[model samples]
Target: MGCPLVSIIVPVYNAERFLNETLNSIKSQTYNNLEVLVINDSSSDNSVEIIEKFVKSDFRFRYFYNTTNQGVSHSTNVGLSQCKGEYITFHDHDDVMLPSKISSCVEILENNTELDGVITIAEYISEDGSPLGTKTALPDYITNNPFFVRAFERSYIPTWAMFMRRDIINKLEFDDNIKIGNQDADFFLRLLYRRPQLYYLSNPQNRFRQVSKSLSKKSTSTCEIYKKHNDVDIAKLYTQAGYSKVVIDYALAKANLWRENIESALNYIISAHERISEFDEEEKDNVYFIYATCLYLNQLFEPCLEILQKIEGKSFRAETLNNQGVCWAIFGDLTKARDYFESALSILPEYIDPKNNLFALNASESMPVRHFTKFPLRSVYKTI
Candidate 1:
């Protein structure tokens, strides 16, 4: 039998810089039966001409342009409306799909009758097309967890990395209301609510281009997504899935912290503490660190120090010590703060934060020592 047709949706908006490379990557796909839908969201640049070049050359490539500059979600919805294929996936105009991406994802869906979708890990690329590094997702862990649970952890799966049955569009569509960012998160969360059995391949099938204007820079939208889902219904869903309420609350706290809403972050972390038993040792340490950081940021130094004293794990030992030092300095004890900073340095001599703090401490005997609270605790949790 011939290969089943696969529809790839390309949403373009002033992406002339990367349009040729993106379309070329799609054209080179190993899977021949493809319907490439290029939706131009009113590009003021030469993106339309670049898109037209492909449309004129290839019968499989179809181009559509929006009159007004609709958002990515709207352009994607328009592509979804027109695509007719056995499998479909979204491709950002600025990103490049590996030549075998379509073939690889289709092979999995073709073989796994029980799976409704396939998502692969993605390799991150710089704006100049050089390899920056991979994302924070550990393939073994992320694949084991439910997509719904993993959605709250961190964004690893880009739109181009996911391939699904065409029928999913029949049931779900992009939320055009997500104006700023987190469009993929909101859409995937809604998709996970229907409980689609998805397969996550360890091998990366796309290169996600990271530019200055990428949506990941928008922290306010991330805060909005977390707040929008902090209700009892979302919490209950996680609990039913065997994840604890603490998970949701901690995520909200982290989200609020990103946007520098210290009071809200502190409140959410405090709420997370109410069911802290649900977390394992590592997760507990993460929560404790965030709790302390929130308190420290909110001027509740006493309780923050108390929380810091309770952390017994080596996971955040350096960060905890540095924060404790800052608290001491704020309390008018420069000597004690210096000792704590030295302790952190002894534990991690190469650590940047504590080194900076220690240097600042030695420079002055004044209060308010330089504090460093960069905690990369997002991917630390194992699938629970």
Candidate 2:
């Protein structure tokens, strides 16, 4: 059989600044049998012009423009409808695919007929293409297990790094209603529900650009609303899939925590704790961490530390230590807080939460007590 054709769908908005680089990355893909679809969602910038130029220059490049400003999901759906290849993938207009991205994934999927899709790691890049860090779609343990647990807890495979068969793509559609992000997670969970064989490549072949204007960075109420909506749907799906209720509760608790709905978060964490027998040691530790986080948020510092004391594992030691520092900071024990933050940093030097907390703590000590009150525990604490 010949190499299957791959269709790369890119959703563009006001991405004129980096659109050319993104297009050039796709053009340079080692995989030659590919069609590039740039769907412009009524961009106010020169995005459409750049896309048109690429289309004119490359026969494999196709351009589509929305009449009105639709969201990324809508633009992606439109591109999905236009794709004519056997295998498919997606890209963001502001990101660039490594030259080997398409070929690497294509080879894996082509070799493994059972796999419905293949996912690769992504390298986080700054606006100017400088390296920020790297992230994997799934954690090491979850990746080794290759089970529903990974899908339930963190189904955050970036669209840019995923390659799916057209048949799978035909069976799925991005929920345009999920306006506040997590659309990719929701889609991934639904797709994984079908129990399709999947593979993960640890090689970082996609450069995910992190910008202040990205949907994830938006903290508006509208974004929160959509995030909660999507989270509710995902939670329900997980419950229906007959996964452990503790995991489900933990997921809901984390979602509520993100929305700052302390009451709901507390309730979910309580449920997870009450059914602690249903979880493994690692999961139980995670539950304890979340429970402590909820307690810390509610200003129950002593009880938060109590829960942290119950947690027993190195898996979440850094985060748990960071939370302990936050609790100590709130209890007017800056010395203890500093010690905890230092301990957390010793555990994970690259962990940003403890570093931020340490910085905030030092700032508070240098400033007047009244001025320090402005930097509340909430501001210093990272979410679970």
Candidate 3:
């Protein structure tokens, strides 16, 4: 019945610039019962000195150092092994939590006995801590049981925005083998499989610092690394949980398509289409859109048009029409492309891509149709 202790595990690696601000945010939390575990991952900078300062000032602050530079996963696992709180959470060294973050999450979990974890919205901030924007860990449509599918589609859940019961934390381990990225998604998928009742807190109480040199900001090669290392393991995990392989294939296909790996995307798309019965109408249309876009990208204009025709729903009509316009533009049929773009604009009058395509077609001499042809269709699809 007393205020349960919360363990905040932060992994630091040469984060000397932001370490003071980050620790100060935690130290100023509204909730008093907290054990701050700052895992020093062989930081060569004055990160250790800063952490030692905090330890000297605060009785609740704990610091542990790794012998060598292991990654975030390993450092976090070390913190996990050492934490002795009833509830557990994670903090990134560069990010800062609002004062109310701990109190809000702790109150929710304590009151809702059925909930295993709670997630809050993240406000993205620049290096100087200026506000960029806000993002939710899960979309409006995703809740509780559908978290696995949503996490597979996109790993939007920020680690710093989550608070979990210690038992739930004990049930999962961060996969150290996932070196490149998306280790959180892999761990979260496994956790969701256990059917833990999860809750979403929409308040923007977590400030996520978006640094240009972060791993996610790296080149497309990092994405390829994630696909190679973690995608297969995630797919296998979903399969073992009795979910259809088609779902996994669909998500993988989208990821490959996003990475512009046309051939791999096509393979997964084909596999998903072969088991089309596994998806509902809306999901099927989404798959159709991806399939059609792939065909159009490969310059298979006629077949791409054929696949787009099979899309039955109104949900993706504007996107379908815009892609149809792109296909026509690439095939050098400017007049037909203009028509499709106009039709798409009729559906969604402010649709940017189609509007731009229409402008390009009409002003052909100023902006040659060939220019649109060379433009990557994947970029256009991303806007939708």
Candidate 4:
């Protein structure tokens, strides 16, 4: 089989530390016939030096530097415009693509010409390259039809793991206005209207280092999530762009997610009890606690107690007991509340929640003396 022409874009900022490893990994890829483009987004560090070294040593590597430090989106767009290959993918300065990453993605694009792009799960790693074990599973595609839009949301997919046709790249430009992040997500979401099928690697296909200064840490919440807080507008974007069903599905899913957040943060029992079935069974402690606490707050005592009883471990290991105390205290039953609070304290002695509940249950306005100094209160006369 003839090898496909692939363009790999690497946007450099201050990537002096990990850039070499990333380049080496790419060069070592089993697949050849590759054009590697490095866009030096005006680095004041050794990134340009490293790029120069790579370009000087290899004919396949080409690089350009920006006069000023435009954000990543701008740099990516520049590289996108310059890519002459049939298939394209971009990598951040610090992240590493597996040796098989490009070849594997390219093959998928070739075989599935209908795909706008291919994506895969990224194995999250620390600076030291130890796996953090965070992964998004992609079971739906292999078992079900993947050439549709909604199938993409099974997990978080990023640009590094994706290879798109140059035609798709030509039609879309990275939105540079988002200084911190998420322009790619928005652009990709817009494309889902066409029901572009996306293929992901069977496993995490790259190593994504969790650096302190990555776009995630620097970006606004909206940018980090790559979703607008107001979905109606985003839905409108998808609707106008062509994928009306995706908009609807996103709206429904978003509503459920928000409901989860609210359920997780609930402080009232009665209100919470009404939403019990909404809680996913595998939610973390915070999620369950929020739901149960809300149920207690709403005065749905029996159901609240029942759910509270089911909770086993969490930051709120004491939540069931503490909130039970609330139910008792509100019903003119201070004794029962105190007992429940004490039970909570027994389960987690260091936690302040149960302790605070105890103080409130006892009608003691004075909170614990958080700091204490102890000297011999009385002078020791002699060894006794």
TM-score of every prediction relative to native:
0.80, 0.78, 0.71, 0.64
Clashes of 4: 13
Model 4: per-residue lDDT, tens digit, 1-384? 458788998888888999999888888888889999999888888898888888998888989788999888888888888888988888877877788877777777777767667767678999988888756454524211223333222222456766777776566766787665665565565555444556655566678899877765765343234333344544454455455352344333433343344332242323333444543443323334444444544445666566666766554455566766666666667678778778867876875666766666455634331111011111111100
Better of 2 and 4 by TM-score: 2
Error of 1 at 82 (Å): 1.9
On lDDT, the candidate that comes out on top is: 1
State each model's CA lDDT, in order: 0.77, 0.73, 0.74, 0.62
lDDT of 3: 0.74
Ranking by TM-score: 1, 2, 3, 4
Best by TM-score: 1
Which of the predicted structures, 2 or 3, would earn the higher lDDT when compared with the native? 3
Once fitted onto the true fold, the runs of candidate 1 whose alpha carbons sit more than 4 angstroms away are 136-147, 153-156, 215-220, 244-278, 309-329, 332-381
lDDT of 1 by residue, 58-140 (tens): 99999999999878888889888899988999998888888888888887778777777887767999999999887655463
Q: Give the per-residue lDDT digits (tens) of candidate 3, residues 152-229.
A: 554545577679898876747776766435656556656655656677777787898998776445322435434543
RMSD of each: 4.2, 5.5, 6.2, 12.6
| Deviation (Å) of 314 in candidate 1 | 5.7
Q: In angstroms, give how far residue 265 of model 2 lies from its true place.
A: 4.6
In terms of lDDT, model 2 sits at: 0.73
